[model samples]
Target: MTSSQEQFVQKEIQKISLPSANTMRLLEINSNPEHCLQDVIDLVKLDSALTARTLRIVNSAAFCPLVPINSIDRAVSYLGEKMIVGIAVTESCGKILNQPLEGYESPAGDLWKHDLFTAFAAKEVARYAKNGMEADLAFTAGLLHDIGKPVLSKLLENASKTTIDALDHGEAKDYLAAEKLVSGVEHAEVGYQLAKYWQLPAPIAAAIRFHHNPSEAIEEFQPLVYAVHLGDIIAMMSGYSTGSDSLQYTLDSHYENFFTFSSNELTKIISDTETAFRPALESLAGKEEN
Candidate 1:
């Protein structure tokens, strides 16, 4: 994006410092299953709104709580270790989710809604990949994967509206291309910076950078990063206009080999995504945003 656009992203982001040191400490618990379930509740209790948001998610039907999950601790146990981290990050990325992206076709909160579906799709891919990587990290990474678009858009706020207009018409080659022509850095690079600044795990930051180019995935994070790449693509194919990436985005053949799907299965993913749409959007909306 143009230097002005880059400034816009930086200006908005600078408003919010990274989460408190305590929250960064919580981000670490994500790597360990043994600690994830217990520790997430402790982390969220520091922010009452997040605690309440997480509890509601755990009590939702996808989790099938035996009883209404009455507290963060119970909710954490019900969701188990993997889910706790996913829920926490989902809660953590609220600002990114709610923020505006001028160049994206999506309307207010629409991008965030699509991000939620992508997270769900990523979780499904991880489960089916059986890649030893935890699903929550994949989910959170997928959900916030394109967060830098907003940063870039804001950066371009006062510039001419043509770039944003092209994005609305779906004519931009990709966000990175448009962003580069308008601003110096692309969303991926900006997002990578934001993720690191937020103290997100390295794998997640890596995924953000490579979600559009899984072939570039570093050796340490390949399979999981690849899973998120496909997950976000599939999520967009299912018809949520969250990003410039779409069915048009290339899926790496090497990585596609990892997951098997028949036409029937493909149909089911679309069906599941459609079925979950309103509810998922409502879930995010109902939460008291941070």
Candidate 2:
């Protein structure tokens, strides 16, 4: 990014609120392999708003529980750690994530759908991963991977065509490079800045920073990063893209080292991602509407 763009991004970052303390703690606990359901429940109980939101989602039409669930413990368990974490993030960052990106030509909610699908796809991809990766962590990482787009979208207004032209002329190898060339910034770096500002977990910050180029991530985080990378591509391939830049980025073949997916398994990942996406969308959308 140019000096001016960098300054603008930093200025804008200051205007955005950091994730809530409950949300930050929730992310940390979710990323811990040793954490149990009680940990999440305990944290949720500390924040009444989040607690109420959790219960609301559990009883929402998406779940359609035969009986209303009044207990925090049961609600957290039913929603799962991944869903709870998602709820927390939505509570904190929904406004930014749900904004329309006139720059990318994507409408409101497009980024949310894309990120949600990517989260599910990354979680599915993690099933085939080695190194004892956490699927829930991957889900969280994928959900926030494109956060920078909202920050940079206005700056990129009307620049999509130039970005595409750069790609065609080989001035840039992929959309990310073209983005930097056209606007002096790319979404990933802008996102990394936001992640750091929010004090998000290191792995998640790394995932946001290096998702488009997994190999650049440190060895410890490479597996998680690759899951998000592949998940991102799969999200776009499934047509949940954020517009103009869709499918314009390159796929890093190095992901093959971290995951092994048979053609059938890949198909199933896409199918499973779609299956999980619908109700989650309905639940969240219903929450927003209400």
Candidate 3:
């Protein structure tokens, strides 16, 4: 990003509103970092919408081959604690995602589909990395990664339409850069601010802020960001909208050099993951209709 782009991104970030840090703390407490599966389950049970959404998903067509996960615990046990964490967070995120964001040229619920696809793709990458970072976290992180775009777009109003149109036409290099070029700020900085406002876990927040350009990420999150970047690229190639935003990839040859997997390994991961989660994501998205 150029200096002007950097300045633009910073200037635009001032316009967005995000959830409070205290709320994020409450979310983290409910999520239970100590691995208390029961605490997470108990919390999920209280949020009626969340509980209904989760159960509906478990019993949906995606899980049809297996008998319905009769109750919350049954669903938890069936999906495992990590995946449950991922599911709960994604459900929480779904509320905002379903809203229409004209800034990105996204209609009513398109953002959720894009988010779900990225989350599923991120989960696949986490499964492959097997680096002890839970798959569910990766999934949630992916789903929320682009969250700043909507917030920024909402704040900028008509001013951002040109940027959104450019992204839709594949004319922009990177979403942030394009946003900066037009609105005077990038989405990553805006997202980071939003994450902080939401009190999201540091890792998740960092991942969202840096997923587009993993090369500059700190040590703890570099791999996860790498996975998300690759996942985003693959998703675009597979047919999700790359938009006019995020057209220019910040990857360097070194990123390829450092990637430990062979092309064949990545191919299999992408193919297998798409097949595994497409139905699940589609079913989850359809619940809004009922």
Highest lDDT, which number? 2
> Residues 1-290, candidate 1, lDDT per residue (tens digit)?
55665576667667655665544566567644465455676777887766766777766655456777687777766655444444555555666667656555445676676677777777667766644667776666777687776676565555435555555677666655555666667778888878866767787788888887777877778877887877777777777764433454556777755666666876776676566445555545654232
How well does model 3 score by local distance difference test?
0.64
For candidate 1, give the lDDT. Answer: 0.66
Off by over 4 Å in 1: 1-9, 20-23, 32-36, 41-49, 56-66, 80-91, 156-175, 243-248, 273-280, 287-290
Provide TM-scores for the models. 0.78, 0.97, 0.76
Query: Tens digits of per-residue lDDT for model 2 on 125-182?
Result: 9999865689999999999999899988878988878888899999999989998998
**Alpha-carbon deviation at 90 in model 3, angstroms:** 5.1
Write model 3 residue lDDT over 1-290, tens digit each, in one string.
55765455556454444433333443475334465667667766776665676677677766663666768877766655445544554555556667777666556676666666677787776665644555666666676777777666654556555776666687776556667666665667778877775667777787788877787788877766776776666666666643444334544444453355678987887787688666666666665335
Model 3: how far is 117 from its true place, Å? 1.4
lDDT value, residue 177 of candidate 1: 58
User: What is candidate 3's CA lDDT for residue 130?
Assistant: 40
User: Which residue pairs in candidate 1 have backbone atoms (N, alpha carbon, C) closer than 3 angstroms, thus clashing?
Assistant: 1-179, 1-182, 1-183, 1-184, 2-182, 2-183, 5-155, 5-156, 8-155
Whichever of 2 and 3 has more TM-score, that candidate is 2
Error of 3 at 99 (Å): 3.1
Poorly placed runs, candidate 3 (over 4 Å): 1-36, 81-91, 130-132, 155-173, 252-259, 287-290
Which candidate has the highest TM-score of all? 2
Once fitted onto the true fold, the runs of candidate 2 whose alpha carbons sit more than 4 angstroms away are 287-290
Which window of ten consecutive residues has the lowest lDDT sum in model 1?
281-290
What lDDT does candidate 3 reach at residue 224? 66
- Greater lDDT among 1 and 2 belongs to 2
